[model samples]
Structures are given as structure tokens and as C-alpha cells.
Target: MNKFIVVTGGTKGIGLAILQKFAQQGFDVATCSRSQKDLDTLKSELEKQHSCNVIVVKADMSKRNDIKVFSDAVIKLNRPVDVLVNNAGYFAQGQICTEPEGTLENTMEANVYSAYYMTRELVSLMKKNKKGHIFNMCSVASIKAYPSGASYGISKFALLGFSKVLREELKKYGIRVTAVMPGATRTASWEKSDLPEDRFMKSEDIADLVYASHALSDKSVVEEIVIRPQLGDI
Candidate 1:
């Protein structure tokens, strides 16, 4: 049985980069996206390009039912899950004071609840063998407050805190959990930004760190990683 990795929201951005990186290393990948078309395309591309199993499921991570749908897809594979990236998230820039009602609730549902539900379903699989690594895609917003970024920042902060508690609980199980807090990265999310492409880090930069962290010795686990653009937050 080949070791496999699972990633959510893996059709684009940092999630896509991480999926490709793992596939390149000969790991079978199971990932999810909301777009069935994108998932099919990604499955074909990765299988053809990397010569590995590419299981792509259509899932809306914010919903527990949908998370179960994705989890069932992966669990049926019956492969050892070596790494799981809870990368599905939503980003909306809005001030806490003036933002519409349920702004924070919506953001938290996507960024925090989604990861929580997905992990609850999959961690048991990892626990079965007492092995695996889990990465939560946090943000620099988790540690710093910025204007018009309240919902995102608050959700990210809660996510980081969740990762911390998960790490503590899973330590004895030999399942490592890491919080990845990255600064601005060039992705579709920033298509409208006026900043130069060089101003923000590339998705691959964050992907590289994720791969490296998982490659470390089983006895050595990175608890948290914070990376930023050279010029700093934009």
C-alpha cells in the first residue's frame, strides 16, 4: 500500500501547490474542491503528470455533511494517510464594526468549523495506525491585527489556537499537527490587487515549507511555522 496525502481545497492556490509537490514525490494524493470540473481536471493532470493515484472529490468543506462525503471517499481508499492538510478556507476583507450581520460567523464557519469537522472525521483513520501529520493553513492575520481584516483575522487566530490544542492532544499518538501562518501570497485571491507580483510570496514558497516540515524525522515535529514576504505584509 503506497502512502497517501489528503488535502482540502486543492484545486488552486497554496493547496494546489502542496498537492503537486506531494504528487511529485510519488505520494498518492486525495484532495477535494467545490468544483467538480476543476477536480476532474486536476485528477487527470496529476495522474498523467505524476503517475500516481489522484482521488479528487467534490466537497464544500464548511458543511459537516459535505466533509463526511469527502472523508468517506478517502477512507474507502484504505491507504495509510501520511499527511493531511486542512487547507479549505474562505477570505473576505471587512471591518468587524461595519461588516454585515453574521460576517464573523460565516468566516468562522469556513476557516474554523470546516477544518474542525474534517479533522474529526479523518483523525480516527490516522489514529488507527498511530501515525500521520496534519497541517492547518493559518495566516499571519492569526498573530497580527490589521484594519478591514477582522473576520479573517479572528477566524485565523481561532484556527491557530485549535491547532495548538490538537498538537497537545495528538503528541502521544505520534500524529504531528502544525499551524502554518503565511503572509501574502500570489493567488487568484489577489488577482485584483495592485501590488507587484514580486511583492507577495509565491504559493510554491509556502508549499515548499509544508513539504519540508512533513519530511522531518518522525521524532522531530515542527509545531508552528510563520513565513512572510521579504518586504513584509502588504
Candidate 2:
């Protein structure tokens, strides 16, 4: 069977870059996002460009029900997943004391709970097959404290913690887990900033690293990957 990958929030940014990269390498891919229109468009473009089967689903990862909805669709595929990239996430700038109420809650629902619940559903297939890789899209905020980075930082830190625990738990099963901490990526999240584009890392750069990490022989795995802009964090 062809290699299969599932990347969440593939409508744009690093997720989109990942989808394009893997599709070009002949991996049949699946992805989900909040917007059906965008998903449909991505499906068409990747299918046309790479001629690989593309599965698209409309899913708001922040919601548990939607995570199941997307997971069920993948389970129904009846094929073992070769890779899973938990890329869907939320980001907002705020101070813990002054940030809007529920900021931490909402961000956790997106960046942490979604991956937790989604991974719960799919790891079984990997266990059955005895091989798979999972990538959690963490952030530099996970390790550094910055002004106005409250909720997003907390959520990413929790995500990194989750990834570490998962790495330990799944190691015996031959399922590799990687926590990806990226800094100042030039995605929609940074579009509002006035900083020069060169200051941030390209989404494709992360994508390349993610795919490369998975391409290693099954005997080895990269536990964590930290990427930053050439000029450093913005």
C-alpha cells in the first residue's frame, strides 16, 4: 500500500507546505480544517498537481466532537496511517493578567486537547501495525517566556509535555513521536506583523524538516525539533 499521512489544519501555512511536500513524494494524504471551501480547493490543487488521492474533511479541531468526526473518517479508510502531523492550532497575543477571559481555555482546546484526543483515536492503528510517526506542531513559546504570549505559550508548553509523555508511552510500540518547536514562521499568524518576511522562517522549511524526520529508518527517531528564523525569534 502507498504511504499515508494525516495532517490537521492543512488549509494553509506549515500544514499546507507539509501536504504539498508529501503529496509530491507520492504519499496519499488526508487533512482537515475549519473551512470546507478551503479544503475542497486544497484537495483539487494537490490532486491535480501530484495525482495522489487527497482526502479532505471540514473539522474544527478545537472541538472534541469535530476531532472524532475527523478521526472516524480516517478510521473508516481501513488503511494503517504511516504518519500523523498534529498541525491544527490557535495563537493569540496576550498577557496572563490582562488577556481576555478564557484565552487559556480556548487555546488549550485547540493546541492541546485536539492532539490529545486525536492521537488517542489513531494510535490504535499504529499499534496494530507496529509502526508510525506523529508530529506535534509545538512552538518556541513552549520553551521561552515572552511579553503578550500568555495563552499561546501555556498551550504550547502543555503540547510539548504531551509529546514527551507520548514519546515514552509509544516507544515500545514502534510509534515515533516528535515535538516540533518553531519560531517566527511566516504564516497567517505573522501576517499582521510589520516585520520583514526575511525575518521569519519559511513554512516550507519546517515541512522539509518534518518529512525528513519521518524518512529515517524505523530504528531511529528525532524526539524533538526546534526551528527558528535566520535572524532569530521575532
Candidate 3:
């Protein structure tokens, strides 16, 4: 059976880049997005270009029930999951004092809980096989707090912590976990911004790093990576 890779929020942005990268490498790719139309489009595009199987599902990663349904679908494939990328997240800019109630919770739901629930559901399968690589899409906010980053920063911080914990816990089982922290990536999130493309890192750059990390020998693992543009955070 072909090896499988699962990615969340893969219709566009960094997630889409990772999905395409793996598919190009001939891995059977399973990914999800909230938009069914986008999912269909992506499935068609990838299938047209790659020989590997592309499984696209509609899923709201922020909701636990949706994740359960998505997880069940992936598990049904019965292929060992070679890689899991928790890339479903959003950026909500607001200060804690000024932001309305539930802002923090909502951000946490999308950025933190989504990864937590999805991992909890699929980690056992990885454990059973004693081999897997998990990537948590963290950010520079995880390490340094900035203005208007209260809620989003908090969530990424929690995600970084979770990634670290998973790395330590899964080491004994031969499972590798990595935290990918990229600064100011060029994605839909910045589409409206006037900043030049050179000011931001490319999503494909992050994907290349992920592919390299996964391609490394089984004896070595890149636990954490912080990638920034040449000019630095914008």
C-alpha cells in the first residue's frame, strides 16, 4: 500500500503547499477544508497532476465532531499514516482587554484545539505502527509576543508547547513531532496587504523544509524549525 499523509485546512495557503509537495513526492494524500467546493477543485487539480491518491473531505477543524468524522474517513483507508500535518489555523488580531468575550476561546478552538483533537484521534494509529511524523504549524508569535497578538499568540504558544510535549512523549515510540514556525508567510492572510512578496516567506519554502525533515534518516529528527524572511518579521 502507498504511504499516506494527512493535512488539515489544505484548500489554500501553507496547508495546500504541503499537500501538493507530498503529492508530488508520490504519497497518497488525504486533506480537508471547510469548503466543499474548494475541496472538489483541489481534488481534481491534484489528481490531474499526480498519480497518487488524493482524498479531499469537507471538515471544520475547529469543531470536534467534524474532526471525528474526518478522522474516521482517513482511518477507513487502512493505510498507515506516514505523516500528519496540523495546519488548520487562523489569525485573529485583538488585544485581550479590547477583544470581546470568547475571542480567546474561539482562537484557541481554531488554532490549538483543532490540532489537539485531530492528533488525539490519529496518534494511536501512529503509536501502533511505531513510526510517524507529525508537524504542528506554529508561528514566530509562539516565541515572541507583539502588539495585537494576544489571542493568536496565546494559541500558538499552546500549540508550540503541545508540539514539544509530543516530541518527547513519542520519541520512545519512534514517532517524530516537529514545530514549524514561519514568520510572515505569503498566503491569503496577507493578500490584501500592500507589502511586497519579497518581504514574506513563500509557503513552498516551508513545504520544502517539511519534506526535507521527513526525508531524513530514521535515526535523526528535526524537532523544531524557525524560518523567517531575509529582512526579518514584517
Candidate 4:
């Protein structure tokens, strides 16, 4: 059977990079996003470029029902997903005290809650096969505190911890979990920040890392990989 991968936020940025890599390798790619138009366009572009099967679903990861629907669609398309990448997330910029009342909660819902829901649903599918790989797209903020980023950073921190605990819990099932912490990727979202694009890491770099890490023998796994721009110190 062909390898299958399910990626959240797979239409753009780091998620898009990962999806392209897998598609180029001929993996059956299934991805979800909140925009149907973007998903359809992405599906066509990727399918044309890679000549691989692509499944696109409109889903808001923050909604539990949407998460369940997306997961069910993926499983129905491919019985066993060889890999799951939780890359859908939101970045809310502001101080906790000054931001909107529910900003932090919304950030947590996107970054933390979505990861929990995706993993919960996919892990059950993996359990049936006793094998799978999961990659959580964490951030450098997951490790350090930054000014005016209380909510976003905290959410990533929660996801980092979740990834670690899950690695330990799912070890017995032969399912590998990896937390990919990337620093300063030059995505459209980063344009709002003051970071210089030329000097920072790119989404393709993270995509390459994902492919390489998953290529390792089943006996070993890299639980966490923290990547940073060589010019930037974290």
C-alpha cells in the first residue's frame, strides 16, 4: 500500500512545504484548511506538479466537530495513515493584559486544543495498526518567552509538553512522535514581524527535516528537533 500522510494547515507556510515534500515522494496526501478555495487550488497545483493523489477538506481545527469530520474523512480515504503532522495553528500578537479578553483562549484553542484533538483521533487509528509517526509543529517560542507574545508562546509551550508526554505514552505502540521547533521561518505570517527574511530559516528546511527524520529505521526516533536560523541566536 502507498504511504499516506494527513497534514493540518497544509495549504501554506511550513505545512505547505511538508505536504509538497511528501507529494513529491509519492505519498497519498490528505490536508485540511479553513478555506475551501485555497484548498482546491492547492490540491490542483500539487496534484499537477507531483502527479500524486491529493485530498483536501475544509476544516477549522479549533472546532471539535470539524476536527472529527476531517479525521474521519482521512481515515475513510486511507485506512491507516503512516504519518500525521499537526501544523495548523494561530499566532496572536499582544500582551496578555492588553489583548482582547478571549485572545489567549483562542490561541490556546488553535495551538493546544487542536493538537490534542488531532492526536486523539489519529492515535486511535494508529493503535489498530500498532504503527505511525506524528509530527507537531512547535516553535522557538515554545522554549523562551518573548515580549508581547504571552498568549502565542504559552500555547506553543503547552504543545511542546504535550508532544513530549505523548512520545513517552505511545512508545509501546511503535508510534514515533516528534516535536519540530523551527525558529524564524520566512512565511507570509512572518512578514508582520521585524525579522529579516533572507537571514531566517525557510519552511522548506523544516520539510526536508521531516522527510529525513521519518526515513530513519523503525528502531530509532528523534523525539525533538529544534532548528534555528544559523544567523539568529535563540
Candidate 5:
């Protein structure tokens, strides 16, 4: 059976790049996004362009019920996901005191809660096989604190700690967990920021790193990798 890779937020930006890379490499690629229209378009594009097995499920990652439904759909395909990439997230930027309560709550739900639910539900399939690679899409916000980035940073910081514990717990089962933290990435989220395009990293660049790191020998696992743009911090 062909290996399968599952990516969330696969309709656009970094998630889209990772999905394309996996498809090009002949992996059975499965992904989820909230927009059924976007998922349909992505399915047609990948099938036409790459001639590979690509599955897109409409899922709102922020909701636990949606993730459960998405996982059930993926499993019904009858192929175990060999890798899971938790890339579904949102961004909220504002001064701390001025930021609304909704902003903080939404950020936490999208960034942290979504990932926790996905991993918790999806691990059963991986645990049955006792072989899998799980990558959490963390950010520089995880490693370093920044001004006016409290809400986003808090969730990412929690993810970093969660990744560490997940590593230790899953290690015995032959599952490798990695936290990939990129300084700044030029995605829809970054576009909304007042920063220049050149001030950040490309989504494709991060996708390439993901592919390469996973290609390493099974005996050699990278627990965490932090990458920053050469120019400087945005």
C-alpha cells in the first residue's frame, strides 16, 4: 500500500505547499479545510496536475466534532495515514490590553485546541500500526516572546510544551513527533500583517524542510527545528 500523509488547512498557503510536495512524491495525500469549495478545487487541481491520490475533506478544525468526522472519513478510505501534519491555525495580532477577549479565545481554539483534538483522535490509527511521523507546525512565537503577540504566542508556547510531552509518550510506540518552528512565513496570515514580503520566509520553503526532515533515517529523529529568515526578524 502507498504511504499516506494527512495535512490540515490543506486548501491554502503552507498547508497547500506541503500537500503538493507529498503528492508529487507519490504519497497518498489526505487533507482537510473548512471550505468545501476550496477543497473541491484543490482536489481537481492535484488530480489533474500530479496524477496522484489526493483526498480533501471539508472540516472545521476548531471544532472537535468536525475533526472526529474528518478522521472517520479518512479512515474509511482504508489506508492508514503514515504521517500527520498539524498545520491548521489562525493568527491574531494586536496590542495586549486592546485585544478583545474573543481574539484571545479564538486564537487558543484554532492554534492549540484544534491540534490537540486531531492528534488525540488520529493517534489510534498510528498506534495500531506502531509507526508514524507527527509534525506540529509551531512558530518562532513558540521559542521567543514578541511584543503585541501575546495571544498568538501563548498558544504556540503551549504547543511547544505539548510537543515535548507527546515526543516522550509516543517514542516507545515508534512514533516520531517533531515541532517545526519557522521565524516568519509569507502566508495569508502574514499578508495581513504590515510587514514586507521579503521580511519573511516562503511557505514552500517550510514545506521543503518538512519533506527533507521526514526523509532522514528512521534512527535519526529531529525533535525540534527552529528556522529564521536570513534578512532579519520581521
Candidate 6:
């Protein structure tokens, strides 16, 4: 049986690249996004391009119910989840003191709560199987505070801490957990930017790192990965 991998926000950017990488490697890929049309389009394209199974669900990862529904859909596949990538997140820009009241809370909900709820819903299966890999998409702001980063940075810091704790907790269960922190990766988030593409790392670079981490022996786990462009943060 082909291994199964679930990725959140799989319609575009790094998430889409990861899905493509794993699908090319023959892993049955399942993913979710907020847009039904995007899901449908991605499903059609991936199924046509890759021989492996492609499962797409229209789900808003920030909602607990949506996360539950998404997890249930994957569990119904009856295939043990070999990997879960928590890659759904949004970027918010503002100074900590100047941002609107709900900005911080909403950012936390989108970036932190989404990953937490999704992992909580799916981790039991990994524990039951005594095997699995989980990747949490963090950011360079996770470690270094940047001006105007505000809520997004706070959310990523929380996510990185969560990933670290999960790694320690799941070590006994033979599950691997990794926090992926990338600096200035080119994605949809930067579509309006005037900077050249070379100023940022490609999403495929992150995907390749993810595949490499998973390719390692079960006994050797990469707890965290920090990828940056050779030109440095932009």
C-alpha cells in the first residue's frame, strides 16, 4: 500500500509544492483548503498528473469543527496517516501596539489554533500505529522578532514552541515531529512584492527539505529545520 500524507493549505505555495513532491514519490496525498473551487482544481490537476490517490477537502483550518470534519474524512480512508503537515497559516503585518484589537486573536486563531486543533484530531491515529511524522510550518519570525511582525510573529513563536513540545511528547511513541522555519520564501503572500524571485527561497526548497527529513531512518529524526535564501531575509 502506498503511504498516505495529509497537508493543510495544499492548494498553493509551499503546501502545494509539498503535495506535488510526495505525490510524485507515489504517496497518496490528502489535503484541505478554505476554497472548494481551489480544492476541485487541485484535485483534478494532481490526479491527472500523478498516479497516486488525491483527496481534497474544502475546509477552513482555523475552525475546530472544520478540522474535525477534515480529520474524519481522512480517517475514513482507512489508511494510516504516514505524515501530517500543518502548513495552513496567514501573515498579518502591524506593530504590536498599533494593530487592531482583534488582530492578535485572529492571527492566533489562524496560525496557532488551526495547527493545534488539527493535530489534536489526528495524532491519536499516529500514536495507535506507533509511527508517523508531523511537520509544523513555522517562520523566521518564530525565533527573531522583526518590526511590524506583531501578531504573525507571536503566532509563529507559539507554533514553534508547540512543535518542540510535541516532538518531546511523541518521541516515546516512535513518531517524529519537525518544525520548519523558512525565511522569505516566495509564495502567494509575496505576489504583490517588487523584489526579484531570487530574493526569496522557492517553495520547492522547503518541500525538498521536508522529503529529506521523512526519508531519514526512523531512528534519526530531524527535530527542526531552518531554511533561508542565500541572499538572506528580505
TM-score of each: 0.98, 0.99, 0.98, 0.96, 0.96, 0.98
lDDT, candidate 2, 1-234, per-residue tens = 679999999999999999999998889999999999999999999989997999999999999999999999999999999999999997898999999899889999999999999999999999999999999999998899877889999899999999999999999999999999999888887768898878989999999999999999999999999999888987
Residue 159 miss distance in model 6 (angstroms): 0.3
Model 6, 1-234: lDDT tens digits are 999999999999999999999999999999999999999999999999999889988889888888988999998887799999999999978998898899988999889999998898889999999999999999999999987789999999999999999999999999999999999988999888899878999899999999999999998999889989999987
- Tens digit of per-residue lDDT, candidate 4, span 52-157: 8899999999999999999889867647889999999977789877988998889988888999999998898898999999999999899988866889998999
| Model 1 C-alpha lDDT per residue in residues 1-234, reported as the tens digit of each score | 567999999999999999999999888999998899999999999989997988989989888889999999988877778999999997898998899999998889889999998899889989998999999999998899987788999999999999999999999999999999999999888888999877899999899999999999999999999999999989
Model 5, runs deviating above 4 Å: none
Whole-model lDDT values for every prediction: 0.92, 0.94, 0.93, 0.90, 0.87, 0.93
User: Backbone collision count in every prediction?
Assistant: 0, 0, 0, 0, 0, 0
Residue runs of model 4 more than 4 Å from their true location after superposition: 193-195
Candidate 3 residue 69 Cα shift, in angstroms, is 0.6
lDDT of 5 by residue, 195-225 (tens): 7667888888988989988888878779998
- Candidate 2 to truth, TM: 0.99
- Candidate 1 vs candidate 3: which has greater lDDT? 3
Worst window of 10 by summed lDDT in candidate 4 = 190-199
**Per-residue lDDT for 43 in model 5?**
92
Question: What is the per-residue lDDT of model 3 for residues 1-234, given as tens digits with 9 covering 90 to 100?
Answer: 767899999999999999999999989999998999999999999999999888988989999999999999999887799999999999987998998899999999999999999999999999999999999999999998976879999999999999999899999999999999999999998888899888999899999999999999889999999999999998
